[model samples]
Structures are given as structure tokens and as C-alpha cells.
Target chain A: MSTRIHRRRHAKNIAAQVLASAATLLALAFLVWILWETISRGLQAIGISLFTKITAYADQGGLANAIVGSAIIDAMAIALSAPIGVMAGAYLAEYARSTRLGATIRFLNDILLSAPSIVLGLFVYVIVVLPMTAVTNGTTTFSALAGSIALALIGLPVIVRTTDEMLQLVPSTLREAALSLGIPQWKLTVQVLMRAAGSGILTGVLLALARLSGETAPLLFTAFGNNYMAFGPLEKMASLPAAIYQYTNDPNPALHAIAWAGALLIALFVLALSLLARTVFARGKTSHD
Target chain B: MSVASVTLDSNRGRDRTDARNDALFRWALRFCALLVLAALLGAALSTLWGGREVLFGDGWRFLTSAQWNPVENRYGAWAPIYGTLVTSLIAIVIAVPLSFGIALFLTEIAPAWLRAPIGTGIELLAAIPSIIYGMWGLFVFVPFMAAHVDPLLDASLGRLPWIGTLFQGPPLGLGLLTAGIVLAVMIVPFISSVMREVFQTVPVRLKESAYALGSTTWEVAWDIVLPYTRQAVIGGIFLGLGRALGETMAVTFVLGNAYGLTASLLMPGTSISSSIANEFNEAAGLHRSALIALGFLLFVVTFIVLLIARWMLRSLQRKAGKA
Candidate 1:
């Protein structure tokens, strides 16, 4: 290449580098701006009462019911999803690793992993909520159970993907050693393989839980948001995201303040879970290596 | 002789028990695996079933018409469909380039010591809930756009001869453009991470050869790295596009939820998801069915998009394995 062409190419490369750096800075700036806004506005609105009282119409209550409801719903969702996801993943990794069925399931699971949560919510509404409502003769069927089911669907694929990948990482020699001992395939998988992948699976579950807690779309119609404290799986429930969504929509200033507080709590909890999951993942990687 | 026979009998019994338990456990695992497939089928079928009333009743008009009047029990998906497509288009146009930049910065430009932390930071941005974006967009970014970006567009792009009409509108802050920007922000981390992963897959030797030929980093990236991972890169972009199409709460807050399509990007409009979310709560009878139909439409569109993405990525993976 001629010297002039080389210099022009260098100039173009320099320009590209500048643009790339600026893009990174812009991305980080957005993150900081969001965090700053959420913390500043949220801290002002957060008070003891915000945690102690149930939401009141127009202004006088905190997010106690919502916090409790969200906890119940999320716990139930993880409980329902984690076991099935792990089992499905185990099957894929051990029994069906090279099978056509395994590849199909894995592909479907990946698609589900990115499938829209709101569509899942609509599915639950049609399959679970509407049927229950019909059976109960128009009594509201929007409940914590419905919400949990929706969220579980969202979490299920994440757990499956992680567990499958983690299990695949296990040394084949471990399987051979166990099999040489005359261990049953089931026993080897459950006792040894699962133990090896336990921390990795936990990381997946924690990440799923983090994702579930921040979900607003699936819970919009399923749990449907309650103002009062209620724990029944069959009754409408309030969750942090649902409450935040509702409050944000209302024209009331006080409601908006409470919404900010809720957003702060959720953002903090999600960030913490993500951090914890990363730590667990990093530790697991080191141990495995 | 008696003791030996007793021990043999005990061992036989244990083996039988083990066999039985193994068979049962294997069955259970298979059942769980099948359940994942079942869930996907159930979601598709159930939504289709729920939306059948409108699907059959309104026939093709449901998709082609823009009329959405709950009071008259008349509904069509035209406006929301148009909005979803337009906003997602805007999101991809803005996000793809920015993501490419971020990915390039992370994979090539950033110092080795700084790479991991910055990469993790960007990934963490993806972990932030979409709802938080919605809240921030509604409360903060919308106002900023109204004050700054909209006016800039109005003065420059809005004055253009042909496409000016698309930019002309009242700058109330919440509209298709605002929602698109928010969606772009939401998907940048996802696309960038995917890009970074695939970009890293470019053979070091190939890049080195390019550099030895006096090619610049940009030249190497544009000519070598990009073409090598072209399939996966497009797959990643499609993945982000699918997400933008289905995103609900963020767009719901900023989309302004208008009923009809308009010429200007500044006008408020609804998406398939935001419409379902905003109306599913109290909509009754045919109105509910209409929203369900919209959901079904979104489900099918996203499924096709995601399937293509997965296929592209999988093909790339297979080729990589062979290489």
C-alpha cells in the first residue's frame, strides 16, 4: 500500500476507535443516569411506612402487601420451575445427549428462553385463569398461582439452559468411573453429576429469580394487583412490579413517589442477585477447572 | 454353603430393586423433558383457541383494518402492528450500529485489563428490568427528548422535502421515536454481548494476517471479522429485533397508546404487547378476544423471528465445530 493510503486507513481506524469509545461511554452514561435518578428519587419517597403499610387508594399507604406478595409469588415460581428445569436438563445432558429429541427440546427451550413474557401471561390467562373463573362462576381467577405459573414459564428455560450446559461440562471420566462401580445411571446422574453442577445450577436459579422479580408484564393480568394484604393463591395479589406499573399510570403525585420507592427496591434487589450469581458462577468455573 | 446362598439371594434382590428404580427415574426425567415441549405447544394452541372468535369472525380484516373501538366492539390490529414494526425498525437501525461499536470496543479496542470489567458492566445493564427502563423513560428521558432531540429533528430532518412529514409532529415527548430510543437502549446490551462473543470467534491468525498486510483495525473488523461471523451477527440482530417487537411495559409507558396510525414518528401509538397489557385488564367479550388475537399474532411473529435466529446461530456453531 502507498504511504498516503496507509495514513488514510490509519485515520479511518482512529475514527472508528473514537466512535466505539464514545459508544461505550454513552452506554455507561445511560446506566449511571438511570441509577442516579432511581436512587435520588427513590430515597426521598422511601419511608418506614412505605414498608409497614398496605397500599391505600390515592396516597396513604406503603408497599408492605406488595413486597410480601412478590416474595410469595417469586418463591412459588422458583419452587415450581427449578426442579423440573433441572430434571429436563439432566435428561438432555445424560440420556439424550445425541438424540434427535434432545436437540429438538434444546432448540425449543432456547426459543422459549427468548419468547415474550407477555405472551406467556396471555397463555396462562387462557389456560389457567379463564378456566378457574368459569369453574368458580365469575369469581376472579386472577391469583398468585396464575402469576406464579406465568413467571415459572419464564424461568424454566433459563434453568434448563444453564443446567444443560453445566452438566455437559462435567468430565466423561466421572461418568465412566461411576458406571464401573456398577452404579445405576439414575443414581450416578442424581448423586454425582448433580452435585458437580449444583453451584452452577444455583447460579441459574438465582438469575431466574432475579429476572422473575422484575417482571411486570406477566403479572399484569394474572396476579392483577391488590391494594390490601392478601396471601391466598386464588386471590388477586400485589407485586412490586405490578404496584409500580399501576402507580406510574395514575396521575397522583403521591402514588408516583411510592412507585419510585418500589422501583428502587426492585432495582437494588435485582442488581444484588445478579452480582451474587456472577460470584457463584466465577467460583464454580475456578473449581471445575 | 447356607451363608453363601443367603448372600447371593440378598444381592439378587438388591439388583432387582435397583433396576426398578432406574426405570422409574428415567421415565420421570423423560416426562420432565417432554413437559418443556408441552408448555410451548400449550401456549401456542391456547392463545389460538382464545383468539379464534376474532380470528374467524373478523377474518382477514382484523389484521388489515386500523379500527379499534371497544365501545362499538370493533377492533383491528393495524395500528398496533404498524407501531410495533415501525418502533422495532427504529430500534434496530439505532441499536445495531451502536452495538457493533460497543462490541468492537470491548473485543479489540479496550485494554486487556479493562475488558472484563467493562464487559460485565454492560451485561449487568441487560440484567436491569425492562420496567425500570419504562419508569425512567416515562419520567426522565421523555422530557429530555421533548426538550432536545425532537426540536433538533424538527429543525433539520423535519424540513427535508420527502421524509419531512414523518418527522413533523407536536413534541409531547412520548411517541414512537421516544419509545424506539428506549427500546434501543434496552436491547443494546443483549446485541452487544452476542456480537462480542461472535467477534471473539474470529481466528486470531486471520486477524494477524490482515494486520501484517498494513490493514487498520477497522479494516480488519469490517473485512475479516465481520464476514467470518456474519451468520451469527445477523442472528444476534434478529434476536434483538424479536425482543424489541415483544417489549411491553417500556413501550407502554412511552408509546402514548393512541388508537390509530399517524404519519409522524412523534405521534403516540400502541404496540401489540402494550395494547394487550393496557386493555386485558377490563376488556370484555369480543374486545378481550381481539387483544388475545393480537397476542397470538405477536407470538407467531416472534416465533418465526427467533426460530430463524436460532437456526442461523446453530449453523454457525456447527461450522465452528468443524473448523
Candidate 2:
């Protein structure tokens, strides 16, 4: 009687485990389907002309202008954000240990880190783009510079949080040793601490870039969508996300195809960045261990 | 006397070197710290200056009016605000439990061989760009929902009181309910991944102890694991909620951009981000400032949500450490 009861219980447990496993598998399968559908639909529009030619509303145009514009804005954002983010992170980790002000700063930084990208864009639109449009009579309405500034703001908090966390992970003994040798605190941070946390900081920056690259809502107001090619920061330019948005809504089949292609490219870019960060972090861990 | 004087001179030289280094480093650190503060301040100040007109002029009235007309310079943000809140709440309601279930399954039931690949798959979902989600939501998912999901809901619950009101519509599948569903799908991966990570931090010894006591897997998970990681799970949910609330592209694509409060979940609605995205280009003069004001409102709301999330996470961390 006891043996029979145990066997039945064992069977029931196994069945439950299988059911749970199936549920998790189903969740993962949904993700896989989404990816497969995006790629198959998007890959059809990939062609040499897609990369080389500028967008023309009349004859289905390429993403050349959008690609260039995205690159420039991304570059500018990184350049502007890195210095400030790294410095703030260093201060939080090294100087602000257990202080009231440090705690406050950390709290505020966390708030900024998770704040919506759309809000940031709106903030920029209200402050920068709207004012500029008013001053310039809407002729110089949207520019790459304004877009870069908004992206930089979005990038800053992520960089700061990552840098601070990475710096904190570095052993205090290392800092003490450098200080004992009569090395300046600034030099110790830049030369020793920053170098120690280099891979992690880079990972954060890459993640931030990936996050901002796909941002559409923020750019909608500040960058304002462009259909033509323009090179300078002062001129209106297009980006992949904005282009995808524009094309996806259009009734034209050709524009729809381009939108799919743009989606695939953006996904691929983000995936590559994630893989790169993972690889870099894995290598760093092995070396440290 | 000579030896004493030489020793003093050596000590003074070392002290001077230390002082100089400290001074230089302190100056540099201070300068960098100030720059960080400036960046944070700049973001806040710019928004305030740009949004001042709408904020001070209308006060709370801006939030009460439902109409958003850019042509006639009339602006009321109620419609978008309502849509944003309602859709985000719907997403949270769906995503939180689903994520928790997935996390529970992964931590307790899944075989070791399957964990890594499944975990990575979920993380990959999180990494996919928002635009792709928007495109997918626009093309395939919305249509699918319209055809199957909406009809099923309408058929089953169409006669109920509150539930009936929600499901009542033409089944267009491009509205607040659709946006909420998409947001839930988009954020599920993020919340589940975080929850799984936190769940893993529950020591193996704790599970083994429960098992040794002849506890069933479900019992162990509920009595031992769930309590241990409840705070972290809450934090994860809040983080996901933050993303869903601020989500722009996907929601914008499917939300139909109608500005009004509707009792039916299937009806089209506007969100703050969608409103700004759709109309920022065409808006002129005070209409522009009003739009900026809407942005300001969004910023304030997100800022508060994030602050709470951060606080919750920190408290969770402290609790876990104590445990």
C-alpha cells in the first residue's frame, strides 16, 4: 500500500515538472517566432541601393541619408556623454563613500536612469527644438545637433550608473596602494581605477548606444523626421528608427519593404552589441579569476 | 642634534609631497563631480524653461480638458494621460504574474541543460530594438489580435458588466487594449530575466533543506523561495512597468491616436508620447508650448516612478543581505 502511494506521488510530480517545463518553453518559443518573422520580412528589402542611395519619396529610395545621420548623432552623443558620465561615476565610487550627499546623488541618478526616453525627448523638444524653431522661424526646425544632445542626455545616466558600479567593484586595497605610493587621487582614478574598470565601462557605453539607437519617440519631436539627405549637424537629417516609422505607416508597398529592412538592420545591430558586451565581460571575468 | 635635524627634514619633505598630491587630486575630483551635477541640473533646467509657459499659465486645468487641437491653439492633455496610465496598468496586470510564473518555472522545474539557452533567449528578446517591436506589432500581431483574440473576448465576456464594457468594440485591434497587450509582450522578457536572476540568488542550500523535509517542489517554491525573493520580484515588476509606461514606438503604432477617455478597451486612444510624436511637427506658437508641457508632465511622472523603483530595489538588496 505504501509503495503504491509513493509511486503515484512520484508520477504526479514528474507530470507537474513536465508541464512547467513546457510553459517555459512556450514563452521562449514566442520570442523565437517574433525574431523569425522580423528577419524574414525585413531581409527582402536588403540591396546595394538600400545602403548607397538617398531617400526619394517618389521612387522608393534608400536609407543612405538615415544611416549617415544616425552615425553622426550617435557619435556626437557618445563624445558628449562619456566624460561627464565617467567623472560622475568616479566621484560617486571614490569620494562619496557613506556621505549623505553621495546617497542623495545616487538616488537621483537612479531616477534618471530609468526615466522614459520619450520624456527626455519631450524635455529636449520643449527646451531646445521648440525655442530654436521659434527663434529661427521654423526654417531650421530639426537638426542632427539637437538629436545628438537628446541622445547624450539619455546615455548619461546609464554610463554613470555602470561606471560607478564597476568602480565600486574594484578593491579598495588597490586604491590605497596607489595612494600610499604618493600618487595623486585623480591619477589613481584615471590610470588605475578606470583601467581596472575599462571593459565594464565600455560594456555600459555599448549598451547605452544600443538603447539610444532604437529610440523613436524622443527623436520624433527633436530630430523631426526627414525624407532627404543632409550632412551637417545644423540641417535636418533622417535616422533608421524615424525612417522605419515613416515607411511603416505609408500605403506604398516599396516603403513598407524598406521599413522591414530597417527593422532587421536595427535588430541585428542591437544583437551584435549585446553579444559584444557579453563576450567582453566574459573575457574580463576569466582574466580576473 | 645633527641627526635629529636631518630626520625632521626628511619627514617634512614626505609630508609636502603627500599634501601636493592630495590637493591636485581633490581639485580634479571636485571639478568632475561638479560637471556631473551640471549635466543633471541642465536636463531639469532646460525642461523647466521650455515648459514654463504651459505649466504656469494653465496649472491643473491643462490636465482636466480632453481636447487636443493644434490648429486652433487649444490643448488639453487628459486624453493622452489617461491612455498612458490605463495601458500601462493593463500591461502591468498581465506581465507581472506571467513573468513571475516563468521565473518560478525556470528556477524550480527546468532541467539544467535547458536553463542557459532558455535564459539567453529571453534576454535576447529584451535586447531587440523597440522599432522592430513596433513594426511587428503593426503588421502581424495587431491583425492576429483583431481576428482571434478580440472576437474570443467579445464572445465570452461581451455580456458582463465591467468586463463587457471593456470588450465591447468593433474589434479593430488598433487601440489601447492592443497597445497594452503589445507592451506586456515587450516587457515580459525584461521582468522575467531580472526575476530569474534574483531567484537564483536564493541559496541552493535553502532548497535542499526544504526538499530534505519532504516538501514538494511547488510547496518549496511557494513557502521558501517566493518569500525570500518577493521584494526583488516587486522591484523587477516596477522596472518593467517603467519601461512599459515610457514605451513610445510600439504603442504609438497601434494606439490609433484618438484623444479621449473611452470605457471600452478596444477603442483607440492617445498617449503623451504618441501625441507628441504625431503632432510635434505640425504644432505652432502656444500649441508648441502646450505640447512641451505634455512632455514635461511625462517627465515628471516617469521620474517619480523610477525613484520608487530604485528605492524598492535598494531596500530589497538590504533585505536579501540581511537574510
Candidate 3:
């Protein structure tokens, strides 16, 4: 009787392990399906015309305008965010350390980091876009500038948190040695600590960029997505993700195909950036402990 | 003596300049840190400012009413609010068990060779853009569900009393159920990753002692690991809830963007993020303010959910530290 009970218990253990593993494999199968569907269906719409023309109401053209617009907005967003994010991160890591102020900033930054992109879009629409439109005499405009600011807000906390975490990884021993050599706190952070944490910070910034690039909701209210190719940051500009959203909702099969291609392009870019971040971090060999 | 004094003066002058530069640099970083504070303040203030018209102009009926006519300037958010809650609740139901299982597999059962790569593959799903998920859900998953899954559910569970109404609708390929499932798929990675981290915090000694006492893997996991991480597991579920609540594009594509609320999950619905994303443009005056107000409400809800999750994790950490 004891031996039979032991066998039944052993069988149950094996069954449980198999069940858990099966669950994981099932999850993976879904991931595989999504990738497969994206690549197979997405590739059909990719061509030179996709790179050469502006989108239209009737869905005859490509995502060329959106491509340019996305690049412009991304450039502006990165430029606006990088310096400030890095500086804030430096303060959290080196200057404030663990003060009450630091703790408050950390807490707020955490909230900001995960705050909905749509809410950020609403924020910018109220503060920047609406006021600017009113100022421009009801031009019905949604400038790329407004979009960039919204994207910058989305990326800010990500970069700050990454910078702070990366800087925290720099050893206290290093700080002590540099201080003993008469290095000033600010100088030590900028010249010594920043250099040590460079790769990790770069990884964080790149991932944040990838994240912002795919954001559609925030740009919907801010960029407002122009049909025509825009010239500068002052004008409303189309972006790939917004284009995808618009086209996907349209009844035209051609537009749906275009949306698929756009989705693939955005996904590829995001995945590449994520992989690059991992590679850079691995190569840095920095102190994770 | 004169040469030594001159050298000392030069050294002191250089030190003074260094101090000045240092002060400037620290101030600059501090200023940048304050920019984030300013932005956070700006966001909240703008929400309050933008929704000012809705709050004061429309009065309290905006919360209770269901009519949202952009043409007529009559706005109510009850449908979107209801939809967001119900869909997120469904998502939690679908995601929590799967995430826990995935976390367990990764931590306790996955092979040494498979662990890192599998872990990475799962994390990569989180990197997949929400828009892509939206597209895929619209084109592939929804149709697949409408054809195969929904009818099967109807046949199996729908024939029963009381449960039939939930499964009675013609699977139109996009609705609350589809949106909830897509959200569940989207958030599984994030929740599972959190779960994996929390599970890793469970000491090896306890698990090993259980094994030495001839505890089956299931017995050890259930009796030891589950009790240890119960708070954190709930926290992970809430974290997933927060993501589902705020998620825009994915739900927008699959939720059918219906204007009204309904009893059945099979029927179409609208979420706060989706409603705003769908109608914010050309939403003149009161309509626009209403959308912004909707966003504020979403922000408040998500903030509360996140705080609860954070509290749970903090308590778990304190217990872990003490133990």
C-alpha cells in the first residue's frame, strides 16, 4: 500500500511539471504565430513605392511621408529628451543619493514612467497643441513640434530611470578613490561616473527611442497626422504608427495591406533596438551587482 | 619666499575656478531633475485645466449619463468606464494563471539550456509594438475566434442555463471578449517577468528541504512557494490590470469601437483610451474637453491600481527582509 501511494505521488509530480511546461510552450506558440503572421502578411506590401510616395485618402500611394515625419519627430524627441534625462539621472545617482528629495523624485518618476501614452497625448494637446492652434488663428493645425514634446514626455522617465539605475551600478569604491584624489562631486559624476556607465545609458536611451517610435495614441492628438508630406517640425506630420492605425481602420484592402507593412517596419525597428541594447549592455561588463 | 607665494596663489585660483564649475554642473543636473517634476506637475495641471470645462460646465451628470454625441456637445463617459473595468477584469482572469504557470516553468522546471533563450523570447513579446498587436488581432485573431473559438464556446458552454446569454451573440470577430483576450496575451510577458523575479526571491533552502522530505514538486510549489509569494502574485495581477486599463491601440482594434455598453462580453464595447483615440480629432470644444476628462479619469484609475500593486510588493519586500 505504501509503495502504491509513492508511485501515485510521483505520477502527480510528473503531471504537474508537464502541465506547467505545456503552458509555457502554449504561450510561446502564440508568440511564434504573431511573428509568422506579421512577417508573411507584412512583406507583401513592401516595395520601392512604399519608400517613394505620400499616403492618400483613396489608398493608392505609400508611407513615404510618414517615414520622413517619423524620422523628424524621433530626432526632435530624442534631442529634446536626452540631455535632460541624463542630467536628471545623474542627480538621482550622484548628487541626491538617498535623500527625501531623491526618494520623492524617484517615486514620481516611476509613476511618470508607466503613465499611459494617451494621457500624455492629452496633456500636450491641452498645453501645446490647442494653444498653438488658437494662436495660429484656428489653422486646424497639429504641429510635429507638439508631437515631439509628447513623445519626449513619454521617453523622459524611461531615460531617467535607466540613467539613474545605470549610474547606481557604478561602484562606491570608485567614487571614494576619485574623491580622495580631490575630484569635485560634479566633476566626478560627469567625467568619471558617466564614462563608466556610458554603454548602459546608451542602451536605455535607445530602448526609450524604440518605445517612443511605436507610440500611436500620444501622436494621435498631438501630431494629428497630416495627409501630405510635411516640411518641418512646425507643421503637422504623419508617422508610421499613426498611419498604421488610420489605414488599419479603413475598409480598403490595399490600405489594410499597407498597415501590415507599416506594422512590420515598426516592429523590426523596435526589435533591433532592443537587441542592440542587450548587446551593448553585455559588452559593457559593468557592475550589475 | 616670493616664488612660493606666487605658486600658492595660482593653485588657490585654480581650485576656486574648479569649485565654481562644480557648483554649476550640480545645479544643472538638479535643474534637469526638477524638469521631470515640472513635467509631472504640468501633466496633472493640464488635465485639470483641460477638463475644467467638463467638470464645471457639464456638472455631475457627465459621470452618470451614457450619451456621448460629438455633434450635439452632449457627453457622458459611463460606457467607456464600464467597458474598461469589465475588459480589464476579464484580462486579469485570463492572464494571472497563465503568468504564474509561465513563471513557475521558467524558475523551477525549464532546462538550463532553454532558460535564458526562452526568457528572452518572452520578453521580446513585450517589445512588439502595440499597434502590431492591434493589426494582428484585427486581421487574424478576431476572425479565428469568430469562426472557431466562439462557436465552440457557445456549443459547449452556451447550451447551459444562465451562461447561454454570455455566449449567445453572433461572433462578429471584434468585441469585448476578443479585446480582453488580446490584452491578456499582450500583458502576459510583463506579468510573467515580474512573477519570475518574485519567484527567484524564494530561497533555495526551503525548496531543497521540501525536496529532501520527499515532497513532490507540486507539493513543494503549492505548500511553500505559493504561500511565500501570494502577495506578490496578486501584485503582479494588479500590474497586468494597470497595463490592460491603459492599453489603447490593441483594444481599439479588437473592441469594435462600439458606442454603447452591453451585458455580454461577446458584444462590442469601448474603452477610455480607445474612445479618446477614436474620436479626439475633430471633437470640437465640449467634445474635446470631454475626451481629456476621460483621460483624467483613466489616469486616476490606473494610478490607484498601480499604488495598490506597489504597496503589495513593498509589503512583500518588508516580509522578505525580515525573514
- For this target, which candidate reaches the highest TM-score against the unseen true structure? 1
The candidate with the higher lDDT, 1 or 2, is 1
Instruction: Provide DockQ values for all models, in the order shown.
Output: 0.84, 0.51, 0.73
If both were scored by TM-score, which would come out higher, candidate 2 or candidate 3? 3
Off by over 4 Å in 3: A1-8, A286-289, B315-323
The DockQ-based CAPRI class assigned to model 3 is medium
Score residue B107 of candidate 1 by CA lDDT.
90
Candidate with best lDDT: 1
Candidate 1 lDDT at B144 equals 97
Those runs of model 2 whose alpha carbons end farther than 4 Å from true positions after fitting are: A1-23, A57-59, A130-140, B1-45, B203-205
Candidate 3, residue A288: how far the Cα is off, in Å: 11
Q: TM-score for all predictions? A: 0.98, 0.91, 0.96
Interface RMSD of each: 0.8, 3.0, 1.4
lDDT (C-alpha) at residue B83 in model 1: 94
Q: Which pairs of residues have clashing backbones in candidate 2?
A: none
Between candidates 1 and 3, the lDDT winner = 1
Per residue, candidate 2 scores C-alpha lDDT tens digits across A97-151 of 5687677777877767767777677667656776787999978877788888888
CAPRI rating of model 2? medium
Give the whole-model CA lDDT for all candidates, comma-separated: 0.92, 0.80, 0.87
lDDT of 3 by residue, A1-289 (tens): 9999999998988988988888788788889999999999889999988888889643678999999999999889989898899999999998887798987787778777767889989989888987887888878568899999999998899899999999998888999999999888787888999899999899889988988998999999888788889977888899999999999988989899888888889988889999898989888864443
